[model samples]
Target: MSDYQPKILSGGEHRSDDEIMADYGVSEDSPLVIMELLQRFHVKDIMRSRNIISLTRENTLREAKELMRDNKISGLPILEGKRLFGMVSMNQIIKALEGGWLDDPCQQHMSTSLVVLEEDIPVSIALKYFHNYTFGRFPVLNKEHEFVGILSQRDITSALLKELTSEISKLEGKTEAAVVEQRPVENVKSEWVIPYYSLRQFVIVRNDLANAGKAANEIKRMLKEAGVNSKIVRKVAVAAYELEINVCIHSLGGSLTIVLDTHKVTIIAKDNGPGIKDVDWACQDGTSTANDWIRSMGFGAGMGLSNCKRVADTFNIKSVVPTGTTVICEFNLSA
Candidate 1:
């Protein structure tokens, strides 16, 4: 039987939908099934408790700004006796200042067209709200529409990451058990079969600054849990993070995969791109194609690929003019 599989690169070259399904042992109908299961996760499952910081309609813009600064938060829910009145954010503060209302009450400057979330609603619903609006946080209400807590993008990400980690761990356990049970005793004794296992996960890398390095962080966590050497894990983490950030800052968007085996860890990052015009120059230090916006965020210092190569045991890159770019980095476990 041939090991060749079809490659689909509509957006990127990481993996096709079919490839993802095969990797996870899911059928064609599995997407709907998975979404149905995901819908069972309630907002409360991921939301912070009711001890959240909030503002009041009676509070002045100055006070609200001070509260936001003190809490290191971007927004706050405005409440009156446990009832949500409005939402106040830095945008509101700036608007108030422009209108000479810095000392005025929050209600006068707050946004009243609230988009509140229910505690018992599916987290999928909250995800839609997040995709549709630019709000940093949404006020959460209970059955009586009373203020409870707030849900932010960070909260949802943390919850989903935990769920994914748990699922992957369970899958790895099952795979290891199956391998042990199926291998012949003679083969195990001789170590001819290598007794090796592999795991692959696909991660989406967006060009958003707020979400950069998230995939690499999760990969590091998984490697640590899998008993990889701390020194090797750190090196892999540095390379993975640099490559991940490179995809975010330079490419339009991309997919990254971390493949783990008994002896090696491989990271493959593929991006929809205006491919590199000069690979040699790109590999050199202080060579950058990033824009001013990315630089202002303390990124795009022209060191991503070079730094990644420095930490990786082996590295290779391929690119096409208008098609895309792919980078493969490998780290040896037994080294």
Candidate 2:
């Protein structure tokens, strides 16, 4: 194969070569270092546990803000009994504030459903979540659905950054903001807007991820049934399958909403997992945060996100912890 590599975007993240390895909380020098670090530190020792600030749905708006500031936290889990009701972060609170609903029932205003991580889960998983969503922090929960604590991206980044800088300080090292370099597309519309629409949404289950081929075949059939052109259908099917599997493997559980029209296709994916914290690094090839379980499936090799970017004519992502995330991708249709 030719060594020539065209510049292409990674998932949503774009980081320099050095920064990428560093950002993932992996050792800059060797893969073995990452493995060793992961094994040495269990989730309990590494995860920020206990006194996780929480707000009940019955709590007041003022109370939520107070808890966040008092804890110097960005988000808080909303719990009711032994269940994770939802999450409330400064952003959600701000949305309420901006909407002029300070008196709105916190129950009415707070997020009612949330993405969570178990207490004993691996810290590397949390680190990967942070890397995927570029989150500042993610809420933790116990098996009993008790609020455990929050895993702050800052904490992981700080430790990771320190590790990188420390090593670089002694050797050849420097911090770069990372670059998403790609040749500019020419003679085509790079940007387009979906006027407005809605679609039937489906959650990509773990089972489907395990059998993506079958699922992909089914999706192709669905597109045909929907009357989409073969070329357009292939694009949508591939992109949909890749992204759907990405969620099943990466994010907690995300939705795939199919917006169809005589002239276009819009697929929206909304997730409750931590938002993509690093938009740059996720786009790179050969960079992934998948666990052995996912790797065993022969997926999660940092190619899913990149594949989505390639197949979709347009894509958009909006995410916030405690509030959940949304991804909207569009495909052009021939008249």
Candidate 3:
């Protein structure tokens, strides 16, 4: 593993919540969004098995180095039976060689002041630590504080990829159904006093990153042309963008429909699923199941639903495992 470097927090250098939010282009008041996103994911969900490669305090630096090489791993937990002694990494081995302590016992050089995660804690906490620490992995402890397993960034990312694949399958199934229902329809006149005409448009979203945000951008353009209020248009635009990105990143294929009338605008997103296993959890901010690839593209912070909810006057979501998901966001023009 790489050498662990601690982040320094100096006086007058701390960033405020608003500053952090602005840095990320998120709303300043929505810190809970991140918390909600991470609440559903537990450490156990992403931790490697307890049968991890380890070493003993009595082991020599050369042995530790050889073990790491054989296993092709960067860090090893030092343990006495089930109890953790400390942690040793490849960097420590290099340091020991430089200091002519290559034969010294690992306990003398291993890092004892450890940062660890609880088995049941949210993975968000782990993510936070990963952002703050330079360690390649963290030791996981159970309720009794016994070392249970180890978690790495790669493990969390792998779990997310699996979830994304499952969701995409569900979306593909929904796309088949959507095709059957996708036919020409006549517009209905609104009963409102404003004598409004309803306009509806349907766009297909595929899992093509190249065209991810096209549908939402087009929706925004259409709303603007319809003379919608600027504030309302921005809200719809943001919601549409998030939903469209969700389809592109998480679904195999799906459809987004926009219904605009004098009184309100409705955006419906439906996709085949290995649908969401937990609707409430999915709706929380900062709770995303997107893989590392999606995150690498600067997306999938688990804030899609939260952002949509924040802007919409009314929001409804339905999802079923192995089936599909449907999200409806309504914006009242009068509001």
Q: Which stretches of candidate 3 lie over 4 Å from their true place?
A: 1-38, 181-335
Per-residue lDDT value at 80 in model 3? 78
**Model 2 TM-score?**
0.41
All models, RMSD in angstroms: 20.9, 24.4, 10.1
Deviation of model 1 at 43, angstroms: 0.7
Q: Give the clash total for candidate 1.
A: 0
lDDT of 3 by residue, 25-134 (tens): 44424333233334556999878887898988899888999898888988898887777878898789889879989899998899887887778877655666665567
Question: Model 1 over residues 130-187: C-alpha lDDT tens digits?
Answer: 6555677778888777888889878887887787666456446644654553343442
Clashing pairs in 3: 33-285, 37-286, 37-287, 170-272, 170-273, 170-274, 171-272, 171-273, 174-272
Model 3: per-residue Cα lDDT at residue 9: 26
Report the CA-based lDDT of candidate 1 relative to the real structure: 0.72
CA lDDT scores, all candidates in order: 0.72, 0.60, 0.74
TM-score per model over all chains: 0.45, 0.41, 0.49
Q: Pairs clashing in candidate 1?
A: none
What is candidate 2's lDDT per residue for 256-311, written digit by digit as tens? Answer: 66766556788776666766666567767878877664675578788877787788
TM-score for predicted model 1 compared with the true structure = 0.45
Q: Using lDDT, give the best candidate's number.
A: 3
Instruction: List ranges where model 1 is wrong by over 4 Å.
Output: 1-37, 182-335
- TM-score-based ranking: 3, 1, 2
lDDT of 2: 0.60
